[model samples]
Target chain A: MSRAGEGHRVTMREVAQRAGVSVTTVSHVVNHKTEARIGPEARERVRQAVEELGYRPNALAKTLVQGTSPFIGLVADSIASTPFAGQIVHGAQEEAWRHGHVLLVTNTEGNQEAEERAIAMMLQYNVRGILYSRWYHREVEVPPALGETDSVLVNCYGRVGAGPAAVVPDEVDGGRRAAEILLRRGHRRIAFINTTTASPARSGRLQGYRQALAGAGIPVDEDLILEARPDQEGGYGIADDLLATGATGVCCHNDRMAMGLYDTIKERGLSIPQDLSVVGFDNQEVIAGHLHPSLSTVALPHYEMGAAGVRVLLGLQEVPAGGILTVPCPPVERDSVDGAAAPPTG
Target chain B: MSRAGEGHRVTMREVAQRAGVSVTTVSHVVNHKTEARIGPEARERVRQAVEELGYRPNALAKTLVQGTSPFIGLVADSIASTPFAGQIVHGAQEEAWRHGHVLLVTNTEGNQEAEERAIAMMLQYNVRGILYSRWYHREVEVPPALGETDSVLVNCYGRVGAGPAAVVPDEVDGGRRAAEILLRRGHRRIAFINTTTASPARSGRLQGYRQALAGAGIPVDEDLILEARPDQEGGYGIADDLLATGATGVCCHNDRMAMGLYDTIKERGLSIPQDLSVVGFDNQEVIAGHLHPSLSTVALPHYEMGAAGVRVLLGLQEVPAGGILTVPCPPVERDSVDGAAAPPTG
Candidate 1:
């Protein structure tokens, strides 16, 4: 193989020279332009020269001529948001690779003009389609530039009746499964510590909590549904209130919150499961997997959402316009929650 | 002023029609090809039409005509390796965008053929350069294909005298600062908990610890330096041994190790800063920031390393061949370490 000098790429002319053919003939053979007849021996020589020189033909040029490109664009509000963004990117990348496409990811960091510029860049690059995503689940307006491409939303939804297909985690289902984990462990007086942030998750998870209690034939206790800041400190801040409810087990808004509860409880001479079995949401691997006793939690299905978005964008899957597709949030069981915690003292 | 249907980008012909000019004139105006002698009136009309139509000219096409691209390629072993990948991507993205280049990131996940294919894709796309990175700091072989373009390594280095310039964290400095943090807090009998992993961090940090202690006029106690698996459980397992050293303060290999120590110490009826001051490395935001008292520790300088990598790759910074640029790991002060921890009773 030939090695190019610094700041150089082997050109088609190099291949033509090595192949003993005109540059135009080399181009036609390499591009497979059927009408541009080339002798068999010359075509063979061109192929050998290409392999030897490690010559890479311009995919952009081919895209212009053939009207397609093996590229997908992922435009996210922020890719630096840990755990969430990484998994989503991984899922989409794997799926796109399977379909012989590469992903061009650009993080806009929620800046309006940056988002538009990123979208414009994708179009200019001749991306097959765009995956408009968020690091968190939320409702968003479809950027007008997105209308020029086949697009799908991942981990977020477009406003009702005003956007393309989307794939988001089943938030309510995630909540119900978390509650069920504790309910099955014989904890009736369960509390749901929800985030104070007003988003789909705040409401959806709460509704699921209610459904779980109702399904278990336990009377709903409005006071048991507590609100916190949805972080470790928030969970710590609400610890006294959460413990005062006399719940045997609690479902935290997230792993961070669960971590906080763990600290206060331990300080209070309490132990997880023995005194209070706990479950958390967003099985963020770093926190959930490393916590003392580890955390049993529900995952947001970020990977699935990313993969599904690509499928929809590439026409491998079909969804009606304005229809929001949902993927299940799988429950991960670990050491934090258990089935044999004795009922709270009468 | 106009939105194309799905998969349709506004073409030069459309702009020409809207401006009442020929397509050739519109192309020339958008391409900024000064050699074309289009009249000012026609150029002005084309510009107005482009703005009104929300037209995005093909950057790839322009690259073909002008011999340059406004894109940088970043191929990492894995971008989904939380915390590390995200920050590196953020830093590189910001630097590239500042230079009018968009980043096309791909995760090869250490597959050799995939790496080759990714490099080929970048070449075909006419990328201005490539920023090859690893989520973790280590030595790597520069792929043969990388010789064909401008490239820089981030958080990793190539074999001696064999590849592009690199930016890596100053692991030795990170370790020394972590020990100094505890030493400045009036803790003389300090222990160092090092990871068992054989890497730059393990050896470099131990050297730093020795330097800090020596600088304090204290003799190095080899017995006080212990090794573990570089995780929370490892710290927990080594607590008895760590406690046996009569060290009032300790510097952990990383944040996860510090987390483990927190659990075991509290379980043994002890408190941080009150009984045993603690310092950790990595400063992983999720674990370090949310830990009970919040961890005071050293950072890995992932962000700065990433930004520096881009600067060097773009020729904005000069680095001698095979020189590994080191970014300082700044110490973050938090509540975990303090000067008031009572000396261990003899």
Candidate 2:
């Protein structure tokens, strides 16, 4: 441990004295208030002094005077532990830094007591606001301690008129884009493989699949829609049944499912696009990008949700109380989707 | 945004009034200094008042009196954005919380200016210590401003007598274990596939592999050793050459490489643990677990590295100046290793 200068804090007054200027001039320059016209040379000297002294205006002092520190708090269930959801923290942190505030995240890993304790710590830190986030999209009961500050939910929602605003990825739009890609590629018989679990992603994607079919003037085939456990094993378990339907195009619930189907279908003497064009959701880069053919899928917009959550907190974006800000999930085209049509073999 | 009670700070006076005790008694109880022996009834009342009022002792007051806040600062290159490295944050946070200190991380994405600014901010916040971390294992230059406080590097090393201590994963032992598993499984002829890129992981693991073979009295076969890109493509490209070596067991550089080898070798009509037993490193669950046979691989102690980093920072663990603590990487057994040895076929 390098214990040099432990517990030493350089004061603004020191920066002012080093720059040969009044403390008031240093304060105005540091905070960017500059109500009085301070000359450029004085401002440059103050900046140089601050840099040379490695001086930082005290965060504690700022909180004491302004009632809050320039810190945006993000408390999540498992954002730090869960790999796929980490982009949320990255986005929020980038946006917060852009706004001259630091973003601090505390992951409670779904422990109720930890959540409350983390929120209380944020309040003690005098954070500007809290971004209550879940690792995945779901309806969440806002923690009571969060009422002490301006907070908005990310990747989750709550009942109307009962909690803070939310920023979530638009599942329906994501699903629609997945199916429309196959539809526009001249594939009429598209199979929608949805999760067995009842959630916005499952229901919304199925609706979008059917909507795309209806728009194409092609009647919805009930047998073409298959239900699985929303994982690779589930996709593998339902593969034979899927091949029996013989749809030319397949839209999976997520990238994990697509990966499973890819393994099984390839094992059965079939290959993606050459045998059937496949589109997936949640575009998890590890599974999607590394797959043999490289899956084309709909992204989850997790980064956008995190940025939008900060925007909503900072009043840069609007969301009525209990309203949802559904960020768009754009399609990431890769090698999986083939424009050359294949024959249907139902 | 829920703006309820925004900027509200509950004070000791408010808690004293609610608990019917003097400010001095409340202060002693809150700060956990029991110099004045207070009654149990008074303590219970104070606890209740503190909980009900949510009267957290102001952080500024603590910093002013003690010269440092109860916060462990972790500044990393990309712990949050990089999925494999997130366990570092999780482990550090849990340890910090266990010691009644909060862990706040700032990801600078390896920008020098941002790194300096983040370090300066930590000084302003009066952090107890900073855990300077890198996303991957390598040598890192100690940031200049990091000299202001006690600091340690995580998963990276530095010049002795010039920088703080470091804690890194035991890649050599991990590689040795990977080969030992194959050797213990009654396999004589074994091939080790390492990354072409030169790094601690690459060199250390290879050294371990040679050591394992040497311990077993098996002569190292130069032709059996191959190198390629560290990803799946690299693994796949080397599969045919690996088969030509006539080795019954194959050790991979990482899980992604193992995945690539699995695809190609399976395509070539070979099966794991049956025709060839394979083991991988960096037990990335997404790839190693989801593969059809479920890969047996070495697990990187990312979580342990983080916890150890905090222990070093808090002076709970001894890491001599510029010393390296090599944490073990445990082997995760699955279906990839089969003890029922098959014949070596070229």
Candidate 3:
């Protein structure tokens, strides 16, 4: 772990001396060379010492000697365009780099054919693992050939059961966080606007909302929920419908839909957090900041989700064999939500 | 070039016969493997026949057999939370796919050390080429060891004296487009609000504005141009400065700054395209559609820039070594601009 020009770092020689092994032997063990013929007892000693000293072998030097890679093949469904997809990539890259692995990204537009092509490209380069990124939470038909490789699906929980591990955000928790924020502001009559009921993100979020409401001794009213796309127009369309139902607060599935709702509220001659308080998800910065009143949203732990995905793929985390890991969601308060201050009694 | 399970597509065998070569030889050439001992005349003849027949080799079958990859490594500075970066990535991915190549992405966060690591990872994985994406147009210190590989820098150009090919949006053209859009709408006193003159994008854009004014026979007014960062508050500050000078139009470096301008304009009791006209660059979608008036911006031709970058790296296009290729910019006019009808009669 000692850098040539740096001080206050442990040297490989330290591990070698502690493990009672030659420097070359220590190097071989450190590099994880399968061909290294060290005795089991010596290997055990070196492993213990390496673990104790928290030694991280130089990936560059080791890769040069091995003529191969310690890199993970991360073919995102989309990198530049999709916020959710990009966040997953950021997380995976961070985790991979932290664990001495580098992530190679491919932007596939979530097409099965494109996904296969990306996977084949990864295989050609002998990438150690694969991470498939989807635009949102949905059933992704895992590429059949990925069984031989270690992979972690991001955002979407893949349906290919035994192929690769996956990391997905807790939409339910996101919904709950949204509800919690509204309830804490001493408001009830909350409405939910979702793009579609068939979507996992929407359904899971609804479940969290209902759970939160029930926990707070409030009735789960189906009449208050409005299904719509997570876009400005969709939210706008639903906003009037919800306002008609006499709801004072609303939680849109994601930020885009919330933006539409903001317009809807404004056009209806209603002031945010006054006539109707609003809470959105997926704290997208551009949309959040520019929206006249600024949007209050549930900040999905996208970065952490990405790091978790890579960690699971590297077998560094105890993710289940065929299960989804739901990351927690935290609420971000902005001007969108209103305080339900009592009217003057005069 | 044969596609199985489809009705009579031109087979590779036919191409071989037309060129007087074996099927295997045709396959080898199509797969980018020139290792075989084939005569130059025969190779040229085969190439002509394939071109004449418009043969598209089955990338999947070729990859399966020869293990040849068409994966280009995309090293983006970071797309985790940035909107513009994502657009560049989307554009690159689209173009890469058109060229029958998949892009692998790595976020380096503008860290040279991370860039080196990502490059080393790409090399270890044997990527065909590299597309280094930067957040801004500036001279970045490329990894010294990148000499062994071919690369194309995106959004940013390369070194003055040396290094990889590059394809960036024509900042001057974008600036000109913005200027013309505002002018066409009858905005005479236009103000240019930029982050800093030191920024290549800002400087290039300013040059474009000057060029446009010269074309229009309008005098260049230094008082109208103000330097500020491409952030919300910066735009607001610039807007405040521009309004004090009685400028009716504002052109910002990017959309984020433009958003700030909107806030400042609102605070000053000015209506967009009425009291003041505002146009922005980057065409960031979040602010484009969601903003009240919807920001008018100069489209950066992200798709063309990305595709052109791939073309440059794969030698699909003839661009000069150590030179910048500017992609054309077009104005997307929205609610932000209003035609300046005949001036009111005294």
Candidate 4:
């Protein structure tokens, strides 16, 4: 609405000439390139001249000529409310910047329509690729145009006309890691609790839990597996059910659910790592560190997943269709898990 | 290097004529605006025709003519690493989308140069406005061009020069609310622990603490006030220092430092609310819910600020230069704070 050239219109060419540098140098300065070393005095001069001249560089003119930007688009599903989603965006942005790309991000509030709108807008801007993300499990019906674009789905796997790869955490691997930690503590009565909402992540984690117990030569108890909501309250309510079933160790689907378990443990006059040891997935910092005993959980390296998403979009990595790239989940041990002393045998 | 027409190229105009509608009507369908009342069969015909033709609408032309976009750009200091930053972004994106505006987001890693670069990129894309965000306290030197553009700064109190308006949590008001809560619970010996970092927020919160105590006729003890680094270790180190001074209720700067206090309290074998009542700012879900007694905290309405930022950028509100629009902070009561059965009788 505020049209330029209303008064004195200063151009980028003039700033370049005044600074005794090429237009490219001025462009780099405007774009904030770290590699370009402009002296303090020169930097000041350019700043002053630009300030005095009222020069605003045209981003479209510069980038349009370049044909494509190193910038990738990351369209997340409501990170402002959820912390985990933010970590994914952060990871993606860091990687994009390090690899000479800026992220063009958007948030779709778990609405299919909104997602379609965001994708359309990003494509219009001609972003190099997209990183479609969701906090919970849901089917991401990729827009038709998305088939022609390069995108990687984070935390969810999707097929876009046999193109557009998805980079998701190995939920099964994460579950197995939690089980292994519990088994190492010499606990056989370990319980697995997850949200009732059905998705690949939940089922995959369940499979891993069963497999881990089998590998440890312990028979799996179906009764120990509790399906709850995906939040702290969900975990809290289900913890009582687990303790009632005489479970000593618990593996939560994610950190929020784990936090809930702590509440139930505290209310029931039980202590962590002593009465009940807890393990969770998704090493969210606030969830991992804030608890009284400090929850020992599995870290799904969201930052790596984000970086990987960008790499997939840039064709830096050959992502096979239908072959989901599941990154390994590592257990972060805190004070939550207390192992039983070994029995005298042999 | 994938040239249009080199591979199968499908333009929108062809699809429009084939669908027996104007190009504008076809655009409405593609953009998912169903106000035209095209029958289901017609819609299906358009989808089939699009599939058959490989029609990809030309976004470049549409954007140029529009001059303004439905996309609102959000630029944060750093998103990936910070906890609350993601929540703030989510809030803004939610509000933006609700208002039929798509969000265009970028991260600046707290680098002034990177911030400027991100701003330029947003401008080129012709976003409706920009939302500049900060998760922590830092002296932000805004680029000059931002003043001329429609933009708003988040978690920022004041501006250096002529710039867009800022939306930050009313730290002083929030602090006042926290103090009021403590006062109601019959706590007189309250201690304020803040970061020594030279930031407006830190100083502003300190002022609020002083103001609240003064207003309540409770003598402010200088010795009870302590400064530490803004992290878990910082909180842990300062817990002993505060407790040693005989303060009954402690208010931490943010949730992060408060978490450290939980660890220190446990190490000291101190029970929460009974031995020492701890109140933290920023109702970080991880901190507020995971603690033994669940720490009581002030939740900054990040979503409200985000929605307000959009309003400011859209010229829905007019603010004075160097002035700030403080978003309200509300207290979330949990188990951490234990008050007397009744208020003390004067």
Candidate 5:
């Protein structure tokens, strides 16, 4: 067996000599430069010589002549630590491949220095474009280096008309969809359990919930809206308060919180969709599908956002500079919610 | 704002003129060729001129001269779909960066054609090394292109001495540790709940369970061992049979199964530590830590394996060709297990 990095590097000149063809003919064949014509017999000889010698075309040399690298750069804020956002990289890689490009990826872990350094490295490589992304959908301070590159932002937003294009999830629409799922099931006295922290997702989702309530001729009951730590424990802690409001249905900030609510409801001798119905955001399959009744939630459009970012960067889609493209977050209906049980008690 | 890909390509001549120096002097400064003699004042002028002009040293030109590319390649199988393995990419990227090389990554989704294509692309880029990995620990037919590149296998193994090195988890040791955790808690009657499918994890864990029982002077009861689907439903379905064996404790195949067991035990009006103690494998935080009593389990060393693969490929560590490195899986003690409550009825 041949070992890599241990043998003398094979040269194109050697391949040309072995094939009895000019170096230019070998170069044209190796680089896929189809404009240059060569006899069929010579092409076959060159191919066989290349194969026998295990010759690999140097991309760096090709880039110097072509004025473009065959690589795209991806600078992720925190890919490994956040499982929910892994699809973003997957989407970007697939899109880049479709266009005959490979991805050079860097995980900065939210370090500003690392982010700048990554961008600089991409620039040095002369990558055709760069994709800047975060683990979640939110506003980001555009990296200063982005001003020097053809870049797109994923799962994040930047300044309007900024040099880089932005692709983000339609959080407000997702929120409205969550509320509409509950309202359509005939629950007007529905309550929303949101995160205690101030975030775009929190505000956008709440706004959508309000819009759905207003469109249905139901007056907003501010008292029914509550906040929690956004985990199972938080959901467990606020369960009594949620039930005391007498709302037959509830929309949670995320699936983790919804799971916690399930525990409290089961402990109180209540059945899902019967005594109480629940809807959640972020339809994480493992948590949502594994629940006793399964969870009805909103799905984050991570894959679409990632694919879109690459498309916009590659000019496959037209996106205005500094403009944000909002991808829709659709509902993944499960067995958690049902039609309204009884009229509102309050 | 200067948009990337739409501006005039800056040349070293322009930077040299701006710095009032020769192009050769500017080139020496930009490429960090310390052997060249240049005064501090001239070097500072070159640096400022390069930064002001936003001149990027051509990596392609440098690679053609140096005979090596400044990047490493990683080909992953289904990274986004399997969140548990995100750490593998993270560890690889970090290690690559520490060595002043960036990572070019691709996700093949287990397609033989795609895997071969990805490797071919990586080779074109002249990557210094390639790290081929999978989402799970299993045997994989080595890609044919691997013979032409420096590569290592992570979380998976290939043909012995097939030229590529391998780094994988020590599954047998992990299983032994899991059974030891249960036995140390004074549980003489312990049942092993494993997967119905034939897998390395299942067989390795079962062997460890037998070893622990033998060392404790206890006979291995065939009836006490059971096989299920290795999921929540499978665990739930096998719960009745598990309890009927009169075992005081259970060592589950994985956390998902243990969670199902928790559901069954709860439905039977039994407490976790008081009525039946449980230990699980793969301390996946979402499932293991979120359980009511929290699950005590063993953690697969994915991050370590990933980091080690890169180290071996970069020649930072010595690993014999075709050698497999087994990393230890440590126990993550949580709240699930406790001292045995009573003697086994059987």
Candidate 6:
């Protein structure tokens, strides 16, 4: 070990000897425990000794004494690769810090072996709790090892009674909010651009769209509902079909799709919120805000979900059995939508 | 503690008793350290006993025995908020895992007190090494406490002899690469769109631009260089100034600015790579790829810097004293740059 390394390993005993006080006094001063019994001069001496010796209390020793580690393990699918979803890690970490806990994050990148290994490692460290998160909202198979630890799921859910508490975005509500935004702008004929694949988000958002139109007493136009890959290319590929439907408003499954739709609209010489109004889900800042006329969309409340997951894991909040919670997705109104123009008269 | 927690606390002693082997044999089997003396049958018995009893060796105890922790600490300014830079954390964490180490990440968000607190906490756990990183590449003040530990800086540097090893993107080289791409495409009348700030990136990139132009024996035209805010609005704001210069190609500080320049060129009734060629730095996927003519730009080596930082901190690679290392930034060729139009006939 280097000199610096040796210096870092300074023992509390050294501080106690230097301060001419008992080891308990040094411990009390360092841990900020009750020091009232110690005289002021002794306490000051202990503090000075600690500073001079650079003595840091061993977290490992503390954990063994307290029977709980001041660390929470966050097992993420791939926070670094996910652009917007990284907020989940940030929110959970900040929340952990607020409770005097540090987060130990590991990215499994969707590998089952890695997930199991990470969970096992966290258990070895006696992490107070674990937050298992996915890069995107979806179903996940909870690692069996995770069952042996206090844990919560973020942005993902597992089979009932298989995992700990989970907090996820309310995709259905987000879909409804997107439709409602268009509807509030007086567009009775709203089209929904959904994903071709079967996903919780796809189905949930579709359900919300249907419910919103049904509540508005508008006859559901099956022809206006289109399915494509939930990306820019998918939206671009389906643009002609979307325009052909004659719907004045379009609600996309995500911001990427909406951006692609925006490109097609501009290429066709149609103006945004003038010839058509567009709304997208997931208020991805880079995509939504950078769009020419900005995208009005639904915000996924990822921060709230992450914070809630940590709270549940730390016992700061209670969760119902089978441990699934959905945080609301709110509407973020931007320049992408406006009141529908009066119907063209012959 | 829950039943699961109690089960997780099962000791190696119990595993050894169950396997009918000595504690030392069980330790050797579990740690995969010098098990050659133990018969295969004994190893199999220990493994089975461990699995059956759910015995997990405490990392804290293991650290005490090994004199080092199998964990690295990453203290970041704000990873989640930085879109593309998240790759840095990902790369570091992945590399750490490859070496049988996990990264414990904490975000300070530029709060000095939080930084000190985070560093102190990591020291308490005796992290094997620390990777101190910032969201953007710039000079940073090395927290005095960091000197007491094995550490490295990623995407940021510190005062001379003031901190640990550092790995940062070679911004000057990136700028030169951006200019070289345009020059290779037959653009000598290239304009450099620089940032209006006194940032290291701005000055370093400008220096590279000048060096490239000078190396090519092209007289540096003062009129060809312009300053902007290094964002879309800034690029848009300088549209007329850039156009009036009659430059055949433009190199922007970043992709956002290039996208703005693209819009301006198109709105001016000009075609990309036909009327004018464009190049940008930092191949930001959302902005660069989504442009009509995808941006040709320089890629910041954030991932490499992060991985290298970890390697240096772990002593897996050597770094010069004073601890400054520069990773290469390569050019990502796209459709944005093309042969400059033949010099206008007099």
lDDT of 2 by residue, A1-346 (tens): 3222544656778889989999999999998986778999999999998888767777766767776578899987875456555778878888898898888778787888888888988887778899999877888888877777788999988876777888988888888899999988888878899998878788888888888888889999999999998878877777777878878889999888888888887777776888888888887856788788889999888778888999999999988545888888899988898774654342
Per-model TM-score, in order, reads 0.96, 0.90, 0.76, 0.77, 0.94, 0.92
Model 4 lDDT tens row, B210-285: 8889988988999888999877778888866887778778888888888788766756666678777888888875
Question: Residues B165-209, candidate 5, lDDT per residue (tens digit)?
Answer: 888888888887888888898888998998988767878778888
lDDT for each residue of candidate 2 in B211-239, tens digit (9 for 90 to 100): 99999999999888989788888988997
Q: Per-residue lDDT tens digits of candidate 3, residues B1-346?
A: 3222211234688899999999888877877677888788888988998776655554434443444446678888868777567667777777788887777677876677787877766655446778887766677776654554577787776568777777877788888989998887667777888776476787889999988888888898998888897777677666546766677677888888887777656655556767777788877766676666888889877667777888888888888545778788888888887765322110
DockQ per candidate: 0.74, 0.47, 0.19, 0.28, 0.54, 0.48
Question: In candidate 4, how many Å is residue A230 off?
Answer: 4.0
Report lDDT (Cα) of residue B54, candidate 1. Answer: 72
Model 3: reference contacts kept, as a fraction: 0.34
- The residue-level lDDT of candidate 6 at B115 comes to 86
Interface quality of candidate 3 as DockQ: 0.19
Model 3 TM-score, 2 decimals: 0.76
Give the per-residue lDDT of model 1 (tens digit) for B61-146: 77777778787898877666567877788888888888888898987767888788888888888788888888878888888777
Which is better, 1 or 4, measured by TM-score?
1
- Least accurate 10 contiguous residues by lDDT in model 2 chain B: B1-10
Docking class of 1: medium
Worst 10 residues of 1 chain B by lDDT: B337-346
Instruction: Report the error of model 1 at residue B150, Å.
Output: 1.7
Lowest lDDT 10-residue stretch of candidate 3 chain B:
B1-10
Query: What tens digits encode model 5's per-residue C-alpha lDDT throughout A25-80?
Result: 99999887788988889999999998888888876777788787777888887766
Q: Candidate 3: what lDDT?
A: 0.73
- Clashing residue pairs in all predictions, respectively, total 0, 0, 11, 3, 2, 0
Return the top candidate by DockQ. 1
- Candidate ranking under DockQ, highest first, comes to 1, 5, 6, 2, 4, 3
